[model samples]
Target: MDRAQEGGINDVGIGALFGLVDYRFEILAIMEHARHLEEDYGCGPHTVSFPRIEPAEGTPFSQRENIPHPVSDKDFMKIIAIIRIAMPYTGIIISTRERPELRDQLVRYGVSQISAASETNPGGYDEEGDNTKAKPYEKTGSTGAQFTLGDHRSLDEVISMMIDGGYIPSFCTGCYRKGRVGADFMDLAKPGLIKEYCKPNAMFTFREYLEDYASPETKEKGLRLLKELTQTFPKEELKRRVEGNLCKIGEGERDLYF
Candidate 1:
């Protein structure tokens, strides 16, 4: 943490790879690490990734064969919930290491960020320019990745899934852009008032994605979901502003936020 700060890095993510030791002890140690960062450097982790061990290509036979403490789906859910309760403001990032069903459940259990469409190998993002196409959704046995992933869905698919689950896929960075960090961000999040800004930001961003990036099928469903979610916002004034902002985005404007 200190080294990151010294290097002028404002945001740093901290995590302990699960399955090495007792998860209970690890969670407490993670909390203590966060506390230490705050106490000393005035900033704790910006995000945390809870990844379990998975076999990767080229791993030594002996290392790959050795069994470690395994984390079950149920226990993983408990860890996410505990972390959410322990650190209300820190962004919890769940990777694609968990299966789709498990990832879905974790989202509802306090996972805020997820790598729904991740490719571990180089050039995986390029389809035409590079020979390395998007790797198949599977464990990292065929390629060189630190760990294998479970979820293999694309970004569009993930967005559609989020809508189906009644969640607006967000691309907003308002809080961070506005310099909210450390204790300040936590204070707002702890009281549950961050949603006042986050909800509208999500709607606007989703509107933008639907207008520009979404496929015809995804756009149709996404817009319908957006309309439905709009009606659910309690404050008429805020809702009106969100509608206006979404309208602006549709007019080719961008980067609107609360």
Candidate 2:
């Protein structure tokens, strides 16, 4: 981290693998680490992820019996809520390491970043699954996979779930592109102003995804989500900009953002 910052890589993420140590100790260490970075660089972590250990194909240690420090579901939720309160500005990531139900529950709670439809093993994406519609995807016994994923839903499936819950499934990368980093990012984030840029960007990206990739049902639900979001947007001028962007997107514009 020190070398990255000194070498001009200002934005970085910090996290602890939950099963590596006691969850209580790991959470504290994560907080302290964030504090350390903030004191030295005037910016804390860009994101914090707490992926619990999952079983891996050849690793005996990954088995429940061999695991050293396992975190229970209840405790994991507490960790998420605590991190949200402690450093509310930082991104909170929930990966596919968690079960689908838990991952769904998490996004509504405190998680701000998530991964879906991921293939961890080398060339894992190329393999065919036996049941594509399984509620929780089964690992296809792919060798070389570092760990098994608990959530096996496709990207569209994941996004559809989020939309069903009235959550905006965002694919925006505008802030980094706009050079919102370090102190600049913090200034907006701490004041909650970043939402003005982020929500609209999310709408833009969601719209783009619906137009290009979403299933017909997903597109309908996603469009409804867009309407709710636009109607509820707090700022008027920015809402107009968002409206314009959405219009342009309908006319084939791509990669628009705040």
Candidate 3:
């Protein structure tokens, strides 16, 4: 981490697999680590990922009963929520190791990022296609994955579900692009001014995806959500800017952001 900082890459993310050790201990460690970074470099973890262990091929430790300390569904949810409340500005991410229903709930609880349509193995993406789609429900077999995934939905499928859940499928990379990193990101985020950038940036990226990649049904739903969200901004000026960006995205502009 220090090496990366020395090399001028200040942004970093950190995590611990929950089932390897007790979740409580892991959470405390995560908090202290973030605090340490902030004290040392004026920046902490940009994101914190909490992936519960899942069964994997050729690994006894990956099995449910064999895991050193297994985290229950209820406990896992609490952990996510705790992390959210403790570090409100840092992005909390949940991976496909979690079940679909749980992932949905995590979004509501505090997960800001979700990894979908993942190909975990080295050649899995190039050779095997999406293991989530190919082996949606399989848990223990060798399907060319590091571990059996719990959420096996495709990107479009996941987007549809997010829309149903009243959450925009965010692909926003505005903060990094806008040079909001390390201490700089915390400045706006701590006081809530980040919303002025986050929401509009999310819409811009969502618009690009809806225009170029979404299925007809998804596009319809996403556009409607976009329209509704556009009206939600407290500032009319920002809302109008969002409205214009949406138009340009529809008119073939790409990579537009705040």
Give me the runs in candidate 1 sitting further than 4 Å from their true place.
Answer: 6-8, 61-65, 127-142
lDDT of each: 0.81, 0.86, 0.85
- Model 3 worst lDDT run, 10 consecutive residues: 128-137
Off by over 4 Å in 2: 126-142
Candidate 3 local lDDT, 7-83, one digit each (tens): 88868898998888778899999999989888888888889999888888778888888999998889988998999
Q: Tens-digit lDDT track for model 2 on 61-82?
A: 8898887988889999999999
* Tens-digit lDDT string for candidate 1 (97-174): 789988888899999998767767654667543433656547543555666678888788888888889888998888
Task: Spell out the clash pairs found in candidate 3.
Answer: none
Error of 2 at 55 (Å): 1.3
lDDT of 1: 0.81
Clashing pairs for predicted structure model 1, backbone only = none
Deviation of model 1 at 212, angstroms: 1.4
Best by lDDT: 2
**Model 2, clash count?**
0
Error of 1 at 36 (Å): 2.0
